[model samples]
Target: MLALLLAALQAAAPSPGPAPSPQSPSQIAAEAPAAEWVDITPNDLLVMELAPAATGRPRRIVIQLVPPPFSAPWVANIRTLARARWWDGTSVNRVQDNYVAQWGDATEAKPLPDGLLTGTEAGYTTQLDQQDSVVAGHVEHTLTPPITALRRADGGLEVDPYARGGVGFVGGFPVGNEGYGSPDTWPLHCYGAVGVGRNLSPDTGYGAELYAVIGHAPRHLDRNIAVVGRVIEGIEHLSSLPRGTGALGFYERPEERVAIRSIRLGSDLPAADRPRLQYLAEGGATMTRFIAARQNREPPFFIRPAGGADICNVPVPVRAAP
Candidate 1:
């Protein structure tokens, strides 16, 4: 099973595509690991809820993704695999500033005594934002990802077929599409988004591996990877890690990579595990106020507003229920 999974992952992103658009090498880092399913739909049962720290007070945060003139968001529910299981929380291990903030076991640290998957890798893997694809022989999963983003200032969104765009928000999710102006919704690979991991192959993952976004906006990657979810909380932990000096920006030494205490699904947690929380409503009045505040942030850092905001700059807001 592990051998088959590994082969499948290699087939997806076979180290060849037209010259990558000038998005960023960081785009490569934001790349996703493979999963059994290429698509995440209403049928797939999953919902991401932010769990707070020892502080007791809910670690409230505003998701920085939705477009302006809208701020408050609502809670979102993702379909699970029908049957439920608990997944634990993993620690952030690698940190590369303005690039990515990653955490999880590189390979399953725990060796399955008899190899449960029979032929597959075991427990050292944890979920991060997106897996970085290497140039030489590294493979990526084949994803017909659908991006949802706001059109450019001219009312036209990214139309280049080599890339993808539709530009919009769903709940707290950022997405894009293949058919322009059509009703298709795939995942968007915005900064800090989370996805499963795989080796140099496709469908070789089982949703255990994951990564996070931490750099430039890599829009061209839409519909090309499996976007599981975003880091609804605790980004600072990963973002503040030391930068890697390695070629593809990996931590130079093993010790530099952070550690994962454990990573599990919120559902898997005990009754005390469920954290009380609420996401700001995109259409709510508060969102409208927040949009204006960011779009025209009179911050001391800026002497001038870019006068326009990119979809990547938008923040999906979350806060404790008042």
Candidate 2:
């Protein structure tokens, strides 16, 4: 009877399958089906034209505005400013090393167009769709299970130093929440992120003055400032500019500032001039593969996989629309 039982147990054991092949993040993204890519609406695109580089190459930066339900008032003001051509003739006034590249009226005297609304400090964070319950004065987020691609293989949320709820892509932008199940979610300050320049509290920026993070990801600035958009293309134009000599990276001399030719919404541009772009959808199968590959480095250049990746390190893949 013992011999029979042993034979049965051995038969019941499952056969082993082949080990999965390793793939790099870019490889996974390239292999993704076209259907996994989502088109960016022209109306939501902000195109800024800077003066040509010394090499005479045209310099154009494409910015994708955060979708509605986040920074609504500031977004509205940005649209208004663009329609009125308010940023024309303005200059990039600051280029702080390992920080940001700022622009607007360096004179700080540009008259904002009419109908531009002032954003309040409260607008900095958007309430989460998921509700929170208070337990002993501590808020507990009741997160729904595994909604994003940025989850561990066993369905655990990725860890983030800046967000207790952890970080994930929201509308193709990296965002953090209070907890995995927390009630508040806000956009992040990853490199190439664009935000409004404000003086101090109670004075949220009106979107007239803007800055693009050209250095390290300033996670500390996450919920403190209004992150209006991000540089989807031509970021090198801003990142490679000379560092500012004045305080806070502001140019000390007027001649040092880089001039802005124009800033316009893609919808306002002619069909021939408008740019069409797309990003991998956050919950798509391709995005899941991409995230996994990013967390685990493969064997071409690396001998050992890192096992984990920073939220900012896993940038969503954005490319020209096919």
Candidate 3:
């Protein structure tokens, strides 16, 4: 009887499978080596404070500016605006459902600070320094030096629905280009991307009016708008806002606007107040694993790994500095 009881207990116990792997993307990122992390300087951070929520919770959004070699003029203008306190007392006037949340001087009467750069429509894309040469029976190309590492598979190329050539991470941002060796590269409109609002085609925005993508990845807007930065923290403050009723999601009533308390560069804040953040280095082993994990979800939850992923789906991992 004791042996029978022991056998029943053993039968009821679940069998262990291969030690469960890092089943999620977050787990992969958590296991990344410390050396594979990259720090975000305070100067590159744009800190925007919104009026507290109904619950009285302070809402602060931290935006990390796109580094050099892309959107230079707009980024510079944003820095200047932050330093000049240009966005103080502004308001988010638009909250398009599955689109964007825009903020600026709603009155449209506030004067922009001096030294704002007038970026051209051409500034929408950065032309990489491309030099093609054949090396060892392979078409080798030397492109611009990358600021943010990129994941290059099969000679730096990946399938993309928007970009005929391909899509990949460049300078830590998702960029679509003609091909692996294409000279023209433009930032993508992924969720949380911060972009300059402009008039018609002729007027590239000078960084005064800004919007954050709060919905799906609007790939169609790529190369048509200037993506200067991405919201690294507190995106929920913008994404969870009430949608606008007016045309194009602009708030019809003035009372509908969400007020902006202040916008400042992180560098201007006191050391303790400054946000210290970091991103997992792209092209690093850990990032590769993270992307793979995202593409192919493992056991416990997902039944079948998709075996593929959208470029936007594999966003780089950012975290508060340890």
Model 1 superposed RMSD (Cα):
22.3
Q: Model 1: residues >4 Å from true position, as ranges?
A: 1-93, 107-165, 201-204, 270-273, 298-305
Q: Residue 69 of candidate 2: its Cα lDDT?
A: 65
TM agreement with the true structure for every prediction? 0.54, 0.87, 0.87
Tens-digit lDDT track for model 1 on 87-143? Answer: 234334455567665544454573222212211221111111123211111113222
Tens digit per residue, CA lDDT, model 2, 1-322: 9999999999999978777777778888888898777788888899999999889999999998886567889999999999999999999999999999999998877788899887788788877664421111111223343125266655777877788877787677887878745567788899889999998787888999999999899889988899998899999999999998889888899989999999999999999999998877777788988988888777767888777788888889988877
Q: What C-alpha RMSD separates each model from the true structure?
A: 22.3, 7.6, 6.4
Error of 3 at 100 (Å): 0.2
Which of 1 and 2 is ahead in lDDT? 2
**Model 3 misplacement above 4 A:** 1-18, 130-156
Per-prediction backbone clash count: 69, 3, 2
lDDT computed for candidate 2: 0.83
135-220: candidate 3 lDDT, tens digit per residue: 11111223434222233333344467788766666545677775566577788899999999989888898899999999998988
Lowest-scoring 10 consecutive residues by lDDT in candidate 1? Answer: 68-77
lDDT of each: 0.42, 0.83, 0.82
Worst 10 residues of 2 by lDDT: 132-141
